[model samples]
Target: MATPRPFSRFEFLIAWRYLRARRAEGGVSVMTWISLIGIALGVMALIATLAVRAGFRAEFVDTILGANAHTTVYMAPQRIENEFTDDVYVVPGRFSDYEEIAARLAEVPGVTRTAAVVKGQVMASANDASNVAEVFGISRADLEAMPRIVDPATSYGELDRFDEGIAIGAGIARELGVGVGDRIRLIAPEGARTAFGVTPRVNAYEVTYVFSAGRYDIDRTRIYMPLAEAQSYFNREGVVDEIEVFVTDPERVDEWSFPLLAVAGEGAQVWNWRDASGSFLAALDMEDDVMFVILSVLVLIASMNITSGLIMLVKNKGRDIGILRTMGLTEGSVLRVFFLCGAFTGIIGTLAGVFLGVLLALNVENIMAALNALTGGGAWQPEVRGIYRLPAELRAYDILRAVGLSLALSFIVTIFPARRAARMNPVEALRYE
Candidate 1:
């Protein structure tokens, strides 16, 4: 039948009255609008910056994990020394039953795909340019699944033929000034023993395709050859170095790793995506935290604007405050009234800013494209960044956290000024009249 009003309602009403009041009515001060704008801009900056940072990390991780497995099961490293040769030692281990292990991994509930991989480093020479490249020997199907590190239009027919050709990154192609049908020489560091001494193993492979994984480092330094070819080149026939496993959920590495590890059996050591890329992800996390801290200083500065506005309001409303205090209004209530006035600005500005920031984050790619169109291209360079467009990923947690921090700082900054207004002497305040 009736609506009950709380102290907060009364405080909000007074704060609203002050906010809408004209110059003649001693309402809405100029500083209040300034403070509101300040808070709005600060929150907007924080949200947009954090969103971009998050997108950068997500895109990078996706690119890396797309071409690689979520987890790798490999034979543990062991030392093999030859007493007769005195200088012969081998630390790189290979496991045999990889096909069985892969089958077992595929049977796991969360496992999506499994493959046995042969990886090695070799010196690649095309024309005058020679560079060290990470070579992966994988099946045709798996190679297609990898991030098209080169133009897909480029013919890769030779890749289907065992030991006939190799796929190189775009970087390798550029540096070597070579393309499809070019011949590249691969020299493995491991060698076979001859009558006199050990000789370096060498082979020439036709370049069947070129890929661009969109990562500059990978595009320039990686190569792909058939798994059989890799094994033959590496002198590990009928054996794979590791069984790579992919899971439905890459984020839950710990959960997926266990079942796959179980399926891999003994003599196999497992490493998840995080195990290989943890340091890189950790660095991104640290940078995100640092950016948050730095941007928060803007909000703190905006809160100071809130403090200034409230202090001015207090001086202008001295007589009103005195009259209210004389009418049995408590000092705590007076303090609340002013505090609510400042808090209202912080709340409104923060909400507005967050809304605007979300819109910006969601459409950042289109926005960049539009900018490029207007600026006659080159505004956003994919060639420079290796990404086709700008990335902006908005997270709800980041928005809420920024809003909370801004409100807390705004609330805290209001205290000193609100207290002074509450403690004013009624007699002295009205004596001026």
Candidate 2:
């Protein structure tokens, strides 16, 4: 027996004929056009929404991770120290153990770098102007490990000029009307209440570096100082408030966190970036869920259009069905023909949408800028949104999922119509036509 050729020219011809017929009627029927449009629109919406969501996630995550370390170790709230009791839950002095733990953690696989950090809420005053800001103390050497604050060419003359220098947020700088080389006074609440009154000590330092993290909170109220200065000013010695850790694999922070915590022993606790920004992360997750659910409805509606269009096509092609059935085509083959037709519509629409979506995602920044220009909104900078530009990371999994969903919907929509066409009696269909 001769081997059957794998590619069936007949099936290809049949499919092509149907497709050409769809194009030649000056376009398909109103219903078919509606289905095609529906599919196109559905796909476009899915791609665009997912792309935007991805952009938002990346922007926010980068901003946060850049502003802080990938993970932090702090005294458990229950174990806060007496000195920091007023403003922060101070943990008992564990500086020695902290250093030891940090050393061990640094040895851990995937752990990049760890540094001691001190943080406090303080009132910053320059001359007569005062503003409340969160002050973070970090080692000057560690600052290099952090994301660059300002352009390398821009000298932080203010930060570099003094030994006990400070870096303030751009917003804070603007509010103070003070720049680098200006002296500022910092007041922190001490745990001790003086005999005369509650005395909050004030320490004066010069503003040195100004950083803009592009986050409203950070850019507005954050200040950075040398860890030693912070420890001295905050009256914390042989004890640091937190240990910030940078990790090589941020996504798998938990993998290193648990083991490192064990090495750090009972006094210290670990927090990943997600834990530090739980509320924001939750909001992002919720937004993604809501957007996906909402956009998926559009695909569902498009699927309905597929159903309606296929049903109509089945009715209109009754005579053709009858002839095909009479010509010895099996019911299964007949069903496959209609299924292929519906599947083709979905596949074409999905491909077109994917192309358009990727193109838009890649150039969303340009598109936004163009729109902003058209609207005369120079203030609509991408940086204002905390992202320099839209970031579209097209994942193969996402594309595969989308294509699979569309094809499944199309197949489901084709079922009843295909079944009806397949079951149509040759005599009845022929007689009716």
Candidate 3:
């Protein structure tokens, strides 16, 4: 008996012939073009949406991590001069046990660096300017851990001026019309004075440095001082508000936090940056989920066009399909042929969209610049919400997700038309023609 021919080049040729014949016979109809365009647009939307969300999430997280330590151990409220405390609320005080706490926390697997932090809200004034600012007290030795607050290269002048001095955010400096070598007054909250009729007290300091942390909140409202000076100013000598720890792996923050809290005892509370910015983080996640759903719907709409295009192909190729089946083509091969045709449309459209998406992502900054220039630079202002330029961060996972979803939807759309072709009776199809 003759050996059955291997389903190799010959099978591919049959598939190719079927594909080409379908195309030649009204396959590039209005419906086909619409399907191609829909798929392209869907892919583009998915890429752009995902890129923007990814960029926003990454940048926002970096900003939070950079501005604050990975974990903070603060004096528990009840322990803050003996007041009732809540799990999330820490009473502000000078933590005398900071060194011990730091040593213990440092022993934790992921701890990298630990430092004392003294934080308090203060009203700052220089000349006729005044603004509410958060004062961060940091040790000179531990300054390296707070790189976001001070860039060594641009901030040497500021760092050198730190003796009994303070670094104000650049925005605060601009608002106050003061820079290095300027003086500013600071007012802190003192205990209620029953004897003095609840009077308030204020302190003064010199603004010896100015730095920009690139975040509006930090640059506009944060100030830093030498740890000792801050302690003295707040009248809490040899004490600190909390111990801030930097971890090698940010993902393990909670893993280290619980143990640190246990070691810190009830006197202190351990907090990660996630707690500090929980609302902002939740909003970011919600926005990303919403955008993904919206973009996926766009892709689904695009797949509908694929369905229409395939149905048109099936109708146009009725006679050819009948002839092929009469020539001994199996129903499975008929299905495979149409499926290949639909898949080709999806592949080409997806590739084109990917090319365009990647191009746009790479040049997004430039494109924003051009638009800003065209709009007289108003669009580049930070006064508006979010950052100045449109940020696009394309990740392999996001690309894979978009491609997989698009292709899967395309395949689903091909099924009905493919089955229709497969189920056609050769005699009936030929008799109709």
On lDDT, the candidate that comes out on top is 1
Give TM-scores for every candidate, taking all chains together and pairing residue i with residue i: 0.83, 0.82, 0.86
Candidate 2: tens digits of C-alpha lDDT, residues 301-386: 88787677777777767888889888877787777777777777777877877787677777877877787779886635543665
* Predicted structure 2: clash tally: 5
Residue runs of model 3 more than 4 Å from their true location after superposition: 1-27, 79-93, 152-156, 189-204, 373-390
- For residues 1-433, could you state the per-residue lDDT of candidate 3 as single tens digits? 4433444454556555654544456654667667777888888878877887787677767766776888888776553233454335444545787778778878877788888878878888878889999988898677655676667544434576676688888888888888777788887776235665644457767777777655667778998888887877766677888889889888557788677877777766778887877787799889888888888888888888877777777787789889988888788778777777778778877877787777777777788789888999876675454343467899998888888888888888888888998999999889968
- Please provide the root mean square deviation of candidate 3 (C-alpha atoms, Å): 4.3
Those runs of model 1 whose alpha carbons end farther than 4 Å from true positions after fitting are 1-4, 7-13, 20-28, 81-88, 147-164, 191-198, 256-262, 325-333, 359-390
TM-score of 2: 0.82
* Tens-digit lDDT track of model 1 for 354-421: 98888888888888889999998778665576555569888889999999998999899999988999
Question: Whose lDDT is higher: candidate 2's or candidate 3's?
Answer: 3
Model 1 worst lDDT window (10 residues): 148-157
TM-score-wise, the better of 2 and 3 is: 3
Best by TM-score: 3
